[model samples]
Target: MEEWTIEINRSATKKEKPNTDQLEFGRVFTDHMFIMDYSVPLGWHDARIIPYQPFSIDPSAMTFHYGQSVFEGLKAYYTPEGNIQLFRPEKNMQRLNRSNDRLCIPPIDEAFVLQAIKQLVYLDKDWIPTAEGTSLYIRPFIISTEPFIGVAPSHQYRLIVILSPVGAYYKEGINPVKIAVENQYVRTVKGGTGEAKTGGNYAASLKAQELCSQKGFTQVLWLDGVEKKYIEEVGSMNVFFKINGKVYTPALNGSILEGVTRNSVIQLLQHWNVPVIEERISMEVLYQAYLDGSLEEAFGTGTAAVISPIGQLSWEDKDLYINDGKTGKISRDLYNTLTRIQYGKEKDPFGWIDIVNEANAVKQ
Candidate 1:
């Protein structure tokens, strides 16, 4: 592994770790963070893991004005034994670079960044809550730091990684949730930045999310921006549908995010010889399946909720109830298998787990 200078915090704050049972999503943070800088000629340099603290960037930073930023989310799990692990971390780094390319930010060394992430997680391993439903959340992001007001891409940027302890996604196992199909507000268009994991894409989704929440729905199911007929994705996840013994999901049509969990589910299904296909599935087609009683199960895949069973979908004052408003058998099986693999409770046939060892992360 390439070397990164480590600066241990003198006054460590691990003793103040929050209670595991009371942990919420992204509400609590760990003690240390990793940072690196990038510029026109310097490229990426000065990698260090220092005490977690707020940055003092200038007010005119390009990220604030032009929103030249990108981010990725994954988790570090504490296994049954005393080791920590990551799930498909390399995929996240690769996706980060994809987003960087779209946003005009400088690309990062994925190998070095993965090593840095393992180091940071090991240093703060005490913050990895051992509760069954709790684990350390890893958030890696990059932002433009040039203090110039320009419409073009900034010349300088900062790559930062932070950790948080998130509680269980559900009180019990994964529970079903209701979603509102968004018809009025569109998420992104083809040939746009929708596929990239950028800030502006999420910023544009807040209004629709708020509107859907006001209607007693947990999240909004977005439609294609141009046609408003084909299904795109959920607000924070990629969707899947099981109908008549075959599984269907919206294809990656340049507008939907290519999610790690989504890919994993498709692979797992194929491994088990289950029928799954990726195509441009429209709402009308899915509703027709529901009308004919072929839509058997529905779930959304992402990092946060590994598998979210969608109980109902509301569209234009009409509701389509799925699986009798309860968690389906396939959704339950997927949630169990994925979570088991993630927590190291099952055999890792996919080589998805990255075991953390302190000896490899520390500098000589």
Candidate 2:
């Protein structure tokens, strides 16, 4: 394995780490970060560990106009034995490659990126919150930075990884969220960049998300663009339903974001012998099932919150309540079990946790 040279920045403040109890999501960042640049001739090079600071880029950078950017979110949890563990990081690495492929970006070696991430996490180990519902949120992104106004792909790019301490997503417990079934705005089409974690796809959803919020909905449940009948995904998550005591989610129809939490949840459900069916779930059928009480629960899965229980779904003039407006048994179980394993409270039968040793915790 190739190792990048390290350059330590001791200029960061030695102030006390923020109280995990009061930590806010995405608000508090770590002291140091990792960055690497890629040019057509040199490839990915000059990777370094540096102080968290903004970069100097030309005003005409390719990303400024074309929005050629991609990102991934994942977390590192501090275990009971004073070790930091990453949850299924390889999946995130693979997905990053997928996003790069779709965005016409060159794919980095998975092993190299993984190693770099591990090193970054180790350097900012103090930023890993230790509270029950707290963890270190890692954001890895690559952007086209070539100073050009052309409409084509840039030959230069920069990749950076930053870390932040975040508290529980729902401070008021795992409160159920309400969703608005959006039949008006389309999130992605059959051959769109929806499957890629690109910036454009998220920018496209902001309008609908704003509208959903203005209408008193927490998130917009997007539907298929062509027919707008089949359920696609939620704002930043993959939707799931519990019908007749079984878990059901929409299949990856090349339009849904394949989330890490979604994959973990599926694995957990199957491990527990719970029935989880992945198929094309139509909006009409989902609503009818909810009306008939077959849809006992609804939830969204993502890296940010892990799993968020959806209380109700509003579409057109009809509203459907899910499991008495509370977190269902399955949702609670999955959340608790996943968090347990993440926090080192439960056994990791699947070996998904990559525990970082203390010697390897700090950047060398």
lDDT of each: 0.91, 0.88
Candidate 2 lDDT score at position 148: 97
lDDT by residue for model 2 over 239-328, one digit each (tens)? 899999888999998989998899999999999999999999998998889878799989999988888999989989999888889998
Query: lDDT score of model 2?
Result: 0.88
Off by over 4 Å in 2: 1-7, 10-12, 359-364
- Give the clashing pairs for model 2: none
Residue 183 miss distance in model 1 (angstroms): 0.4
Tens digits of per-residue lDDT for model 1, 165-213? 9998887867889999999998889999988999999999999999889
Poorest lDDT segment (10 consecutive residues) of candidate 2: 6-15
Clash pairs for candidate 1 = none
